[model samples]
Target: MGPVSFKKLLLVFLTGILFMSQSITVKAEAAYLKSKDVTLMNIGTQKVEGKIHLKGDSKQKQIKVLLIKDEEKKWYELPLKEGKFDEEIWLTMGKGKYTAAIMIHEEGRKYSYGPKITVENVGEVNPFLVPVKHVESNDEKIIQLAEKLIEDKTTDREKAKAIYDWVTGNITYDYEKFGKHQEGDYDNTYGALHTLETKKGVCYDYAALTASLGRAVGLQTKVVKGQVSSELYKGYHAWNEIYLADENQWIFLDSTFGVGGKKEYFDKKQSELSHSKQEEL
Candidate 1:
C-alpha cells in the first residue's frame, strides 16, 4: 500500500483501540457502582434480613450491621456472616415503643444507613442474652467454666442455679472498679473473659459475667438494672434473672449480694429484697 494509505489505516486502528478502552472503563465503573448500594429489607418485628448482590464473585470482606434505637440513643453492632445477615436487632430491654435503625459497614467504605423502623411491645425476645460486645458469653473461658459447672445438670433450673453458685463463689466485688466508675469510667472495658481472669468486678461486671456463663450453659439469662436498698448497699445495682422455662416464671438472683454470703437474695422476690426492677432485660 502507499504511505498515505498506511497512515490512514494506522489512524483507524488507534481510534478503534480508544473506543474499546472507553467501553471497558464504562463497564468497570458500572460494576463498581452496582455493588455499592445494598438493599436492606426489614422482614419482621424481631429480625431484619437482607442480601448483598455483587457483580463479581464473592470474596471475604468485613461486613457489619448496626442496630440503632434513636429514642434511647442506644445502638448495637450485629455480626454478619460473609456478605449477608439475617438476625434479631435489639436487646431484650423490655416492653416499649422503640425506633430501630440499621447502619451497614463494609471494610474501607462509608456506612450506609437504612430507614428507621418502629418496634412495639418487645416482651421477651431478649437478643442481648446472647453473646454481645460486653457480654462475651461465647468466649472459650466462659464456655469451659460453664460446661464444668453444669456438666451433669439436665434441667434448666439446675443449670441456672449452678451458674449462679459459681459466680457467687468464684467472683469478688471490686472496690477499685467501683471507685473508677464513680470517677466516670463507665465503659466496663473488661468484660466476661477479663472478669473471669481477674475473678473480680463491680456490679455491672458481675452481672455481665453471670449472664455470659448462664448463656454459655444454654439458660435464658439476662442482665437486669434496678435499685437496691439494703444496709450494706443502697444504690443503683445491676443483677441477673434466669428464665425457668419449665416453671414458666423468672427467678431473680443477685450474685453481688450472694458474693457477700447473703443467700437470702437467691431466687427471692424482687419486692421482698427491697429491689425495684426497672429494666427487665
Candidate 2:
C-alpha cells in the first residue's frame, strides 16, 4: 500500500511459556543436520520453536532467514541481523513440516540461499500468536513493555486496551513515509520495533505494534490486511484483530484512527466494524 508493515528473547521467556504451557518441549532424537553457523532448538512436538539461533558473519546487510512450510509450501521471509540472531518462530500455516534457510539479499527483493534445515515437530500453532517478519511479538523490549502495561490486569479486555491506549497515544503518524509511499520510493515492511523506537509510522506500523504487544501479553493478535472506508482516508489499510479470552471472541482494533486522543476504534466487536479484512499479513 501507499504502505508499511511491521523478536526477542523470548529472551521475555516467561510470557511464551505462559501461553504455550501445554506445548511439549522435547529434544528430538532424530538424525538432524548440523551447521557451524546455525542452531535450531526445541524441535519437539510443539507449534512454536523456543528460538532459531543463527550466527552469521556475513558482509551482506540484508541477510534474512527464509522459512517455507507444509504442502502449501508458503514462504515466510524472516528478518535476521548479521552476527547473532536469536528469535522464536512458528509453524503458523497449521501443523506440518517446515524448512528454514539463510538468505543474503542481493538487491530489490532478490536473495541467495544459504544454510538450510527441515523442521518436523511443530504441532497446531495459532498463526496470530506466532511472530513473523513483520509482527515480531517475541522481541524482548516489546515483551517487557507488554508485561509492564498489563501488570495487574487480569482480564484480556483490560490488557488489550492498555496496549491500545499506549500505541494510539504515543505513536505519531509519519506523514513523510506516506508521501514516499505515494511516490513509490520504499519498501513497506518496517517491523514493530521501528515504530516502538521511532514513535512514528503509518497504519501498517500501528497494526504491527498493536499485534506484537497483544501477543506478547499472551493474547492472540494479528495484523489484519484489509481496506478501510473512513471519513479521513481509505484504500489498502492495516488494522488488528485481538482475541479476548473472557469474551471468547476476536475484536477489531484500529489505533491509527484512535490516534490524536480519539478512542472510538480501541476495542469493538469485529462484526460491528466496517473494515474489509483481506487476510492476516
Candidate 3:
C-alpha cells in the first residue's frame, strides 16, 4: 500500500478504538452511583429513610428502591419521583442485616446501584418477653426428663440452676468452628441435635440448643445476641434468657462462660447483662 494510504488507515483504527473505550467506560460506570452522595438515617423507632442519587445515561427512567431483610427474606420497595428517591423502611429490633438497592428498568433489562444500608440491632427488647407457643412432647425419654426437672416440687430457682448446670456441663463451646457464613445453615437449631447427641457446640449453637431444651421442659427460654465486655474478651457474643416462673422475670445464663473452663457463673437478671441490644429467638 502507499505510505499516505497506510497512515490514513492507522489514524482511523486509533479513532475507532478510542470511541469504543469511552463507550465501555460509560456502560460500566452506569451500574453504580457515587457512594459518598447517598444519605441514610434512622428516622424513628422501627423506621429508616434514605436518598440515593443515581447517575447513568437512562437516569430519566423510573427507578425502584428495595430494602431487603435477610432473615425474613422480604423486600420493601420505595416510591420514585423525578431524579431523586426516598425510602421509609420499618424494621424489627433483632440481630440481622439489611441491604438497600436502586434498580432501574431499561430496554426490558434491570440494573441496580449501590447497596447503601447496613442495619444492626435497632432497639432493646428482651426476647423472653415475647409469648412463645409451647410444644407438647410424647417421647418417653423427653417426658421423663421434663417431669424430673419441672415437677411441682421444684422451685423456680432450683429449676433454673439445674438447667444452667446441665447446659454448661453437657455442651462444649467452640466459637472458631462456627463463625457465620452466608451459605451456612442457620435453621436456629443447626447444631442443636448434634450438640445434644455429642454435647459440643459454639456459642450460638449452645445458646440455641439450651433454649430448645429449656422450652421442651416447659420453661420459657430465648436466645440473645449481644457484645460481651468482660475482662477476657470484647466482641460479639450469644447467651440465653430463662424465665423464672416464681420470680416473674427473665435471667441471663452464659453457658459459653462456663464452657470456657471458668467457674464463674452468669445468673444475672436480664437487665443486668451488659447488652447493647437484644434479639428474640
Candidate 4:
C-alpha cells in the first residue's frame, strides 16, 4: 500500500473509534438523566424533609412529589425545579409506615419513583384537643335508663363490657337504611327515643347511642372513624375508643364486629393503635 493511502486509512479508523465512544457516552448520560436519587428524612415532631439529586438532563424543567403519610386520606403534592430539590413538609406522624413518590416532568412526559418508610413513634398519645359535648336528649325514659346503667353496681370493665355488648347486640349493620341523611341524625331509621327504645341501629347509630349511654353513666368515650381489619373481616368500618379509668388505656371496641357476635377484642399496644386504616369514614 502507498504511504498516503495507509495514512488516510489510519485517520478513518481513528475517526470511527471517536464517533463510537461519543455515542456510548451520550447513551449513558441520557439514561442517568432520566432518573434521580431521592432521600426522605423524618425530621421529628410531625415534620418530613425530602432531598432529591437529579443528574444528566438539563431539560427536566419541573418535578412533582406526592407524600402519603400513615393512614392519610389524601396525597400531598409538592412542586420542584430542575437539578436538585430540597423541601420540608408538615406531616402527621401516626404509628406506622409512610410512603412517598417523586415524579419528573419534562416535555410532557412523567416518571415516578417511590420509597417506603416505616416511622416508629410509639407511646405517643394524640389526645383530643377539644372536649366533645354530649348531646342532650328530651326523652326522660332514655335518660333514666342511662343514669341507672351508670349508677348500677358494677366495675369499670364490667360497665364498659355491658355497654359494648348492649350496643352490639342491639344495633344491626344497615348501609341502605341510612340513605343519605345527615350524620348523627337517624330520624328516618329511628329517633333517639326509638334507638333507645328498640336498642338497634347502624354503626354510627350504635356508636352515638353507646356514646350517649356511656356519657350518662360517667364514662368518657370518643367516637372514632376508621376501618376494622381482622382475621375474619376487612373493609371500611367504624368503631369506638373507650377510656377506662381502671386500666388507663384506650380499648378499641368495635360495635359492628361486636354486634356481629364476634368476641374479637383488638387489645393492641399503644403503637399499634396509632395507625388508623387508609380510608376515612
Best by lDDT: 2
How much is 173 displaced in model 1, in angstroms?
1.0
lDDT of 4 by residue, 42-152 (tens): 232332232222222223455555555545533333334564555433233444444445555435344555332333333333222111222223246656766665566
User: How much lDDT does candidate 2 score?
Assistant: 0.72
In candidate 1, position 200 carries an lDDT of 93
TM-score of each model, in listed order:
0.62, 0.75, 0.46, 0.41
Worst 10-residue lDDT window for candidate 1 reads 49-58
CA lDDT of each prediction against the hidden true structure: 0.68, 0.72, 0.56, 0.51
CA-only RMSD, every prediction? 9.1, 17.1, 17.7, 17.4
Give lDDT: candidate 3, residue 224: 77
lDDT of 4: 0.51
**For model 3, which pairs clash?**
none
Kindly list the per-residue Cα lDDT of model 2 for residues 75-175, writing each as its tens digit: 45444565455545565665556666766677987877766666664466677776776677888999999999999898999999899989988999998
Residue-wise C-alpha lDDT for candidate 3, range 201-245, written one tens digit per residue: 777767766666666666777777788777645677777778878
- Model 1 regions more than 4 Å off: 1-66, 69-72, 75-125, 270-272
Whole-model alpha-carbon lDDT for candidate 3: 0.56
| Candidate scoring better on TM-score of 1 and 2 | 2
What RMSD does model 2 have?
17.1
Better of 3 and 4 by lDDT: 3
The order of the candidates by TM-score, greatest first, is 2, 1, 3, 4
